[model samples]
Target: MSSPHIIVVPLPIAGHVNPLVQFSAKLVKNGMRVSFIVADYYYNRVMSAIAAEIQGEEDCHVGLQSQVKLHSIPDGLGPEDDKNDMPKLFLSTSASWPAMLEKIIQEINGSDREGKVTAMIADLHMGWALEVADKMGIKGSIFWPSSAAFLAVEFSIPNLIDQKVIDNDGVPIGRQTFQLSPSMIRMDTEHLPWNLNNDLVTRKKVFDFFFNIGRALKLTNWWLCNTSSELEPAALTLLPNLVPIGPLMTPYKKASRQHLSEEGLSCLNWLDQQPARSVIYVAFGSLTFVEYKQFQELALGLELTRKPYLWVVPSSVITSTKFSNIYPDGFNNSLRKIVGWAPQQMVLSHPTIACFVTHCGWNSIVEGLCNGVPLLCWPFVAEQFYAKTYVSDVWKIGLAFESCENGIVSGGEIKNKLEQLVSNEDMRERCSKLGEMTMKSIQGDGQSSNNISKFIQWLKE
Candidate 1:
C-alpha cells in the first residue's frame, strides 16, 4: 500500500516555518509522504531552509527529500503590500489563503501517481487550513510551534470570558492575573499576547485574528505542540488534546554545522576561538524592531560586559541610517562581532556560548534551554513576557531585564544582568539540569519520542 500522505503548512516567518519544515522531515523519515506548502512570497526562503536542513541528514536518509514535496500558493498580496506589518499581512492572508490552499489540496488529491493526502498538520496561526482539511475529509491537526503554556492560555479564552477576565472581543476587562490551572504560574493581563499592542485598533485586529484561530481549532482532529511534557507539566495536563511531540528540532539539525549564509558561517568560526562559556550570544528574532537609541544602548551595554559577544542583527535594521555609527567609542571588533544572521541552533550548541541575552521569543527560549545556556531575558512584546515569566520565575533558569523609564535597557543594566546570570551557580545548575531533561525528551523512550511514535501510528492507521 502507498504510505500515508500528510500536508504541512506554516505561517511564513522564520520561527514558524523552520519547525514545520523540520517536522516535515520527520514525517518523511517515518515512511510518510509530505506536501509542504507555503505562500509564494516566502517560497524561496523556505526552499533555502529546506536545502540547508537536508545537507545535514545522513546518506541513508538523503532519499527522504524526494518524499517531501514543496508547493506554493499566491497569498493574493501585491508588490505594494507591506509584508513586514504582521497584523495587516495576517488579515490579508485570512481573506486569500483559504481558497488558495483549497485549490492546492485539490490538485494534490487529483494527482494520478501521488498518494492521497490522509491528514494536514499546520501552524496554529494558519488554523483555517484545518477547516479546509475537514471539507476534504482528511484528518486535520494544528501545530502549536510555541510553548504549551502559551497554547493553554489561548485555549482557555472561553474560560477567561466566563470568568470576566477578558471580554468577548478578547480584550482585558481589567488588570488581572490568570492561570489555566491553579498549579500553573499566573500571568498578568497586560502581558496577555493580544494586549501588548499599545494601539487599540491593532490590538483588536490581532485579537480577532487569534479569535478566528480559536474558532478553527475546533475542527482539529489532533492538536500537536512543539514542546515537551517535561517543560510544561501543568499546561499539558490541563489541555489533554495538547500533545507534546517536539523540540521539533531534528537531531541532525541539533548537531549540524551547516550555515544559511556566509555571515552565519563566519559567526560560528569566530565562536571557535572564544574561551569556554565566555561569549554572550544575543539575538532578537526577525519580528523585533529595535529603535536607534535602544540599539545604541545595546551596543554600549554589550561593551560594558567586557566579555566577548556575538549579536545577530537582522536585515530590517539596514534601513536605520544611524545603525552603522552607533557602536561604543572603544568598541573592539575583536571582542564584539555582529552578523546579519547566524545559524542559531549551531550557535546555541557551541561550547563558548555562556548565556543568551534574548527577546524571549518562544523559539529562542526553546533553543537556549535545550542547549543548557542560561538567559538574560529582555522581552519586547506579545507572549514574550509570558515566556520570560517561565524562564525567570517558573524554571529559574534565567533573569529578566528592567527597562528604564524611557524604555531603553541601559548599558549598565545589561552588564549587571550578564554578571548576575553568569555568577549564579544555582541558576546555572538549574539551566544545565533542565537542558538535559529537555534534550532527553526527544531521544529514545523519552516522552516526546513516545508521543511522536503514537502520532505516526495514528496517521498510518
Candidate 2:
C-alpha cells in the first residue's frame, strides 16, 4: 500500500505552528508523505525549524515550501498592515481566512501531485477550514491543540448557557457556582481569563466562535488534541471521536535548532549550577503581556522564594526605566540571575527545575507535563483558565492562585503559589507521576501514539 499524503494547515503563530510541525514529523515516521501549507510570512521560520530537525533522517524526508494561498482573505475588519498591532492583526487574520481557504483549495487542486488531496487538518481558531474542506469534499478534522479537558469546557459552553449557569454573553448568569461537564471544575464569571472581560464585543465573538464549533461537531471528521486520554479520560468521554496525540515536542535525543534561541544555551548553563528541583522556571506563552508592576511583583516573589530560577522576561515587559523597581526590595541583585529569553524545553527537562510559574498556556502546560515539572498556574487570558483548571483541579498535579478583585493577579499572590508548589511534597509526587504518565503516553506503544495512528487510518479510509 502506498503511504497516505496529508497536508497539515496551521494558524500562523509560534505556539500553533510548532505542534503541527511535530505532528507532521510523527506522520512521516509512520510512513506517510507530508507537506505543510503555511502563510508566506511565516514560511521561512517554520521550514528552517523543520529542516534543522530532519537534517540526519535518511528515509523520512519532510517537504516544506511557501504558497501565497490565503493573501486575499479580509478578517471582517480592515487590513492590518502593521504586524505589531495585535488586535488588528488577529481580526485581519480571522477575516481573511475564508478567502484564504478558497485560494488554498484552488492551489491544491491545480498541483501536479498524483494523489487527490485526501484530508485536511486545521486549527480550531481557523474555523474556516471546515467550510473549505466541505467545498473540496475532503475529510476535515479540527485540532484543538489544547488539553482534552479544556476542549471539553469549550464544547460545554452552550449547555452551560442553556442551564442559565452562564449568560448568553458567556458571563456567569447566576450567582450560584456551577461546574462545566467532563472535567467537573467550578466556573465563575469573575474567574474567567483576561480575554473574557477585556471588552464585551471581543468576549462575544469568542463565545460565538465556540458555540459555532459545538454546533459543527458532527461535520468534523474527528477532533485532535495535544493531550493523552490518561491525563484527561473524563473529558474525552464528552466527545465521541477525539484523538489525543501530543506533548508533541522536538525529539529528546536529537540536537534540533527548533529550540535554539540566541540566549537559550546560556540560560541552560545558568540552570546547571542551581540545586536539583530548586529553580522555578517563569514564562508566559507567546502572546501574553506583563505590566511593569506585575513583572516587578513576580521578580520579588521569585526572590522571596529564595530559589535559583530562570525567567523569560520579554523586552516589552522591561521597557520602562522604572522596571527595576517593580521587584521586591533589593531583588535585582539578590537572585541568581535573569535572562530575556530561555530555552524552555531544556529548562523544563533539567533536573534542577522544581516548578513552572506559567501563564498556563496549553503548549507550555504540555511541555511542562512532558518533563514532569509541576506548575504554579497564573492564567492570564484566552484558554489559559481552562488549562489551569485541568492542571490544578482535574489532574491534581498543580495549584492556582486567586486573581485580584479587578481580576488581576499580583506578584504577592504569585509568590505565595510558587512557595506552595515547590515546598509541598505531595504536589511534587503527584506532578512527578503525572509527568511520567504524560511521557509514557507519547512514546512507542503508548496510547497517544496508537490513537494518532488510528486517526490517520480513518483519514485514509
Candidate 3:
C-alpha cells in the first residue's frame, strides 16, 4: 500500500506559505506524501521558507523534503512585475491557477510517482482550489492560517450585511463599533479587514474578494485552522468545521537551531551579547510599508528605548518612493542593529529577547506568544487591529501603542509602551503561561495534536 497523498496550496505570501509548509512537514512526518504547490514566481521563496521551517526538526529534517514534492504553477506575472500590488496578484492567480492546478492534479494521478492523490488542502485565501479538487473527485479542506477569531469574524460577513453593518458593496453603513459575536472583540467599521484601505477602489476590490470567499466556504466540509481550541475557545466555538491544528512552528531544540541566512546568525550573535530579557526585537512582516515620516518616528523611537534592540527593516525600504532615506538623520547608534530580515522563530526563542515590537500580523502574534515574549502592538491594516485586541485585551499579554494627532505613533508613545510592556510582571507571567500552553498543544495528546491525528486518520481512511 502507498502512503496517502495530499495537495497543499497556500497564498503566495510569507505568512501564509510558512505555516502551511510547516504543516506539510508535519504531514510528511506522519507517513503521508504531499504535493506542495506555489506560484512559479514565489517558488524560491517557498523553498527558502521550507528550509527555515524544518531547520529545527533534526529527527525528520533529512527525509522530510523528499516526502513533500514541490510544484510551481505560473502566476501570470513577469520578472519585473510589481508583486506588492496585492489586488493584482490575487486576480492574476484567480485567472491563471485553476486550469493549471487541474492539469497538475491530472499529471500527478497519472504518474507512478506518489500514488493517486487522496485529498487537497488550501489556504483560505485560495478557496477556489477546493472547487478544482471537487471536479477531480478528491476531498478538499480549507486551511485558515491565522487566528480562529479572525476567521469567525470573516464568517460573520453575511450577518454583518444583514444587520446593515455593511451593504452589498461591503461599504460599512457608518462609523460604528460592532462585534461579530458577544464573546469577540468590538471593532470599528473602519477597521473591518476589507474596509481599512483609504482608497475606495482598492477597498472594494478586497471586500469583493472576501465576499466571494463566503461563497467558496460552502464548497468544502473541512476547515483546518492553525490554532488550538484551548487558546481560542470562544472563537472556535463559532466555527464548526474549522478544526484547530496549530501554533505550527519548528519545534524548539537548542542544539538543532539553524539560521537560514547570514543575517539571522549575525542578529542572533548580537542578541547573545545583550543581557537576558533586556533587548527589544522589532520586525514588521514582509509587506508592511512604513511611510517616510513613520519610519523616521520608528527609528527615533527605538533609539529612545535606551536598550539593546534588533530591528528587521528590509533593505528594500530604502528604495520605496515613501522614503528619501530609511533612517532618521544622524541615527547612527550602537544600541541597535538593523537587518534586512532575521530568522524570526530563532530570534523569538533567544534568551536575550525581551519583547516583540510588531505590526500585529497573526504569524508574529503567535510566534511571540509561543516564545512567551510580550508584544507592543503597532497595527497597520486589516485584521491586525483585531489581532491587537486579542493580544492586549483577551490574552492580556501585550499592549497596543497609542497614536496621537495625525495618526502618528510618536517616539514618546513607542517608548512608553515598551516601558509598560517590560514592567508589567503580571502580563509577562500571563504571556509565559500562554506560551507553555501553546507549546503543549502541539505535543503529546494535547488538543492540537489530537486534532491532527484525527484529520490524518480521516485522510488515510
Q: List candidate 1 stretches off by more than 4 Å.
A: 55-60, 78-80, 252-259, 321-324, 328-330
Q: Candidate 1 on 303-407: residue-level lDDT in tens?
A: 888889999887668664554665557767569888878888888888999999999988899889888899989887767988898899999999998899988
Which one wins by TM-score: 2 or 3? 3
Candidate 2's residue-wise lDDT over 1-461, tens digit each? 55566667676667777788777766666555565667666666666566644542334543422221222223344343544333444455667766666675677568676345677777876666777777777778888777665566667776777887777777766466556653456655565432444677776766666667654456685778887777777667776678788767764434544446567777777777778888888888666777765666667667777677787876655663454454556566544667776657667888888899888988898788777788888886656877888888877889988878876667678778888888888877887888788778867799887877788778667
Question: Between 1 and 2, whose TM-score is larger?
Answer: 1
Indicate the worst ten consecutive residues by lDDT in candidate 3. Answer: 252-261
The residue-by-residue lDDT of candidate 3 on 1-461, one tens digit each, is: 78999999888878888899888877887888999998776787677666655555546666467777789987777778766656666767877899999998999999986788999998888898988988899998889899887777677888999999899888889889987778767888877777645788877887788878965678777788998876788788777778889889886545343535677678878888899999999999988888888888888888888988999988667776554666778998888889898888888999898999999999999999999999989898777888898898888999998787798889888888888888898998999999899889988889888988988998898
Residue 216 shift from truth in candidate 3, angstroms = 3.4
Q: Which stretches of candidate 3 lie over 4 Å from their true place?
A: 78-81, 255-259, 322-324
Model 1 Cα RMSD, 1 decimal: 2.2
lDDT of model number 1: 0.82
> Candidates' lDDT values, in order?
0.82, 0.69, 0.83
Order the candidates by lDDT, highest first.
3, 1, 2
Which of the two, 1 or 3, has more lDDT?
Answer: 3
